[model samples]
Target chain A: MDFATLIQILDSTVRLATPLLFACLAGLFSERAGVFDIGLEGKMLAAAFLSGAVAAVTGNVWLGMFAGIGASLLMAAIHGLASITFRGNQLISGVAINFLAAGLTVLLGQNWFGLGGRTPALTSGGRFEPIILPFAEAMAPVPVLGPIYSELISGHSFPVYLAWAMVPATAWLLYRTRFGLRLRAVGENPAAVDTAGVSVTAIRYAAVAICGVLCGLAGAYLATGLAAGFGKDMTAGRGFIALAALIFAKWRPWYALGACLLFGFLEAVGNRFPNIDLGLIVLPAQFMQALPYILTVVILAGFVGKAIPPRAGGEPYVKER
Target chain B: MTAMPKWADAVLVPLISLLIAFVISGLVILAIGENPMEAMRIMVSGALGSTYGWGYTLYYATNFIFTGLAVSVAFHAGLFNIGGEGQAGVGGLGVALACLYIPWPHWSLALAAALVASAVFGAAWAAIPAWLQAKRGSHIVITTIMFNFIASALLVYVLVNILRPTGSMDASSARFAEHLRLPRLNEILALVGIPFNNRNPANISFLLGLVACVAVWVLMWRTRLGYELRAFGKSEKAAVYAGISPVKITMAAMLISGALAGMMAVNTVMGEAQRLILNSVEGAGFIGIAVALMGRSHPFGVLLAALLFGFLYQGGAELALWTKIPRELIVVIQALVILFTGALDNMVRRPVETLFLMARKGR
Candidate 1:
């Protein structure tokens, strides 16, 4: 209710929303390219574990991030091989990837670290440090805008800023570029795009690779930026939440930012207040935690509006003779 | 659709896929500095060598049967019902209330009441998503997945506030009344003059699972509703043209699926734990997806797939207990099975089909 609490809540929202933002944007790319990826959670988990393990060993956050991205890209490649190359069921492939990630992460983690599927906590240099923006100290004297700028915007790890910046970058790439036009076309009507001399498979693989890169950043952020180490299933259900946000945002980059922030705000509030007493009725923390999923279901049910997916989504495009 | 014989299509493909998965899993074991052959021996001996092992394996199989059938039913209606985890969790609430509050004179009577209660609760939980998909055009996969989370949270709230015994730190209810406890499999076996592992948790619910499998087979193949459900799943527009209501079929299929998922509570809650606890369903709901897929969504196939998974589960536990193989590797193995049999079926099928076609041509 007070200013400090409000600022704290907003700050937490920024931190929590960063991963969701990266993942939502990732899903946006894949889905917009006609791949229904439910394996985002698995990819993120793999990256999180790899990043944390590599960071613990090398003591370099950048190297850790590279390893994380490499790991995620490998997973994306496997998904591509199964779904795109083999022309298999995309959903089944996604589920397999998820299962593989969940198992392999813990198995390898236990093998290497022996701390029960968890990497050792990274030291300062191994993790992403918060960046204090220029003039933050001097601007502290200013009343309303000062603390907001310094506390809320200034001191986040690099990925937070990268994720925020990616919104526009994604928008530009998705709308302003020729590749974007083809990608959207591939998702909606691949036959038409194929007729135009475009290779649907190449475009789809590119989209999935881009998705892998973003998911790698998101997973790296969770381990190296936010949590310092990776535990088993640390990404939890955030990938699914990101998918929900993708649907909630209607597969748009800008709307994904809003949906991620909203979901993040809900999580922050739930963490801050275990039980909310509003003088009349008390709300349980579990209710708050469950709110996003409940809201997603409501939205998908068309209580809010219709969320129509790409026409060619989920089906492997078959070229006609 | 293939020139291959039905036996080869049904049996040969899955056997080859399973062999491939196990071979890959064996290599993984070797990578972990363990003997692959030794691990296989241990897994088999631990899961089936003793009565104790069989008890646990059957217990796990019982849970899989219920959840697998749930997925198979929904698959028939072309719905991917991934909310089995949540549905089973809510079903536990039904089991808890029935066992704790009702003064059933016998376990049989209590089991009957709990069956209906759990089914109704699970069906109710799945109804919203089914309705949304049927009417509002919402994707059932997304809604059902979201519902799984909601179900977990709801169960937690109920257990923490209402079901937890007073002054107890555990997020579990007090033990159910003695009369409500289902008979363990050992007791039933003893009546037939056979010795069994008395301490093992395998219970009469195993029989219930078998019955459910038969029931599902009859419903899916023998009943008119099953015809309509399958018809709708094959092609919705065609079904509509044939005068079958998509809405009714979707709701019916989902309801039956939820009910089957919910029935898993009977095995975990009344048969084994004898009380409601958080995480009672574990990941059986997700495992059901793989089971259903591997089984080709057929009841008989589901039964075999469930037993295979049950073996892996119980064997994985033993491996963890005695060997260096982490329990999570079993999940990797299961995932590989699913990947080969379900996702990459064409990889093997194509080669085999070609072989079969060549053989026919030679003949």
Candidate 2:
């Protein structure tokens, strides 16, 4: 491919990978804290709908984002109540949240907007626009670095930058903070963490809440930054895809970025070429779309490597027991 | 420490949970400016009032029965097996190919062939995931879920390129020949001199589902393999110590589960639609999970749970058509039912057990 084509593909990859990055980071927190959250998709969908609906009504994107985070937090709280407080099955609770979000978003959206489960399209102030850097225009005349600076690194919606910044923030928080150490311990051995005077329940709840915030941002970005409005089940299966990426990355923040980018690059290539011809045969676009999932299965099957989850993940903590 | 009778534990808990779910759903209806009582009445009349309603309800139940049985079989062997959706989808392809390519003299023979073809196809789809989990230590849940999406994409490719009738705008294949169509419920009932709804889509596959339920019951409770499967599920390490191969049990359970899920296609593609189409499964696979959970993963319980969900589904359609309530609200109701019955079971069970214990102590 030509330089322009390559640049376009990389741009699409950045846009696509941003949401996955946020979601992967979100799952990393919850899973690392001993709470398995398959409900990331549901939280993101709820956030996407709330953000789009609120932004349309208030004409303020920032308010929309806050509302989105609040909605996601509500879902996270319900999940925590079910899995942590009630001591219910974690996977079942996650599935329930997904169903709830899928239904409630469409039901409420249809009732309020009367647009068949879709919010009103956003205008300038209601959506995130791409911001160009100051040096982009001035550096355009330089040959190789010019296009890389202006095209690759410069223009993107605000969430794209936030998602990238979160990678280092997550790493530092996970490795450097006392709370992070406790959280990691809780996931591996809650009894040990409890013996150390940490409240396992509290740490897990906090992790879920943090997950809620990240997922909310991811959803808000999808609704306001990527698309102009929310549609029913707009998150599609990205939440699941993000889970696969989490496994692919071995639950590390830096590796999560790499996995998301790789998956995003695959998606970009699929979108660019609907049908790819090789010397012997042509490959359908669907194969590329399904590649991440296929690869996840392959990786999990030990063809590539092993993916070990947190030791105490998916088990409800019982302090007395 | 026995707090309640076995019968009450089996029946009372689910009934109480269902009641609670409906009460909450009623409030949700009221919030939408609709009369909850009126909505209930409409749902009851729409889903169970007439022969036509029963036909649709039974048709939906038939689909659920297969998927539920599929899930239950896997659950018995300690496998989650959430790939029922994909298995059923591929089963539809099997049904379609059998109907389109083969020249059958009668519907009965065609039905048998289709059943075999679907079971094989579905089993093949599930085998890879099962093998991964059994031998490679891959988590079955993630792999099965991934397979669901891959199955959907695969179905799309086959339908769009290979199965579509020449020059047809739709993505479905041509309808099966006249003799290849399974006999409708009305036709079967008519032979016994009973009046039935001819317009509804329920057909002979309901009988097939009933037969399959009985077969599953016998296999699970009466047979040695079933004992081994359950033992493996209860404690894999113990079973291994007792000389039962973990890989063998996992593969056997998953294959049975996949075959049952595949049987759902006989109802939708052969009996109802008479043509293979995209979305023929229509989330029945996921619904099966709830059914299996509610039924406690037993064949008889699965049958009842499938019937209950069928009522909800048919009734929900009526609510959407007659009232301002959106169709998606049914999904919320289903989720709440699942939350209460499966996830939040201890919430009700603990209170009831305490009450029973107190009563026994007083006596």
TM-score of each: 0.99, 0.98
The complex in candidate 2 yields a DockQ of: 0.80
lDDT tens digits, residue span A1-321, model 2: 898899899999999999899999999999999898889999999999999999999999989999999999999998888888888988878888888899889989988888989999999999998889999999977988888889989999899999999999999999999998998998999999998888898999999999999999999999999999999899989999999999999999999999999999999999999988996988998888889999999889877778888999989999875
Q: Worst 10-residue stretch by lDDT in candidate 1 chain A?
A: A81-90
List candidate 1 stretches off by more than 4 Å.
Answer: none
lDDT of 2: 0.91
Name the regions of candidate 2 deviating beyond 4 angstroms.
Answer: none
Show the colliding residue pairs in model 2: none
Q: Which candidate number maximizes TM-score?
A: 1
Highest DockQ scorer: 2
Q: Candidate 2's error at A96, in angstroms?
A: 1.2
- Cα lDDT for residue A122, candidate 2: 98
lDDT of 2 by residue, B1-363 (tens): 578999879989888988898898888888767899998898899999999999999999999999999999998998888899999999999999998899999988999999998999889889999999899878788888899999998998888888998999999989999888788999999999999999999999999999999999999999999999999999999999999999999999999999899889999999988999988999998888889888989899999999998988899899889988888988988888878887888887889998889888899
lDDT accuracy of residue A45 in candidate 2? 95
| Each model's Cα RMSD | 1.1, 1.3
Show the lowest summed lDDT stretch of 10 residues, model 2 chain B.
B25-34
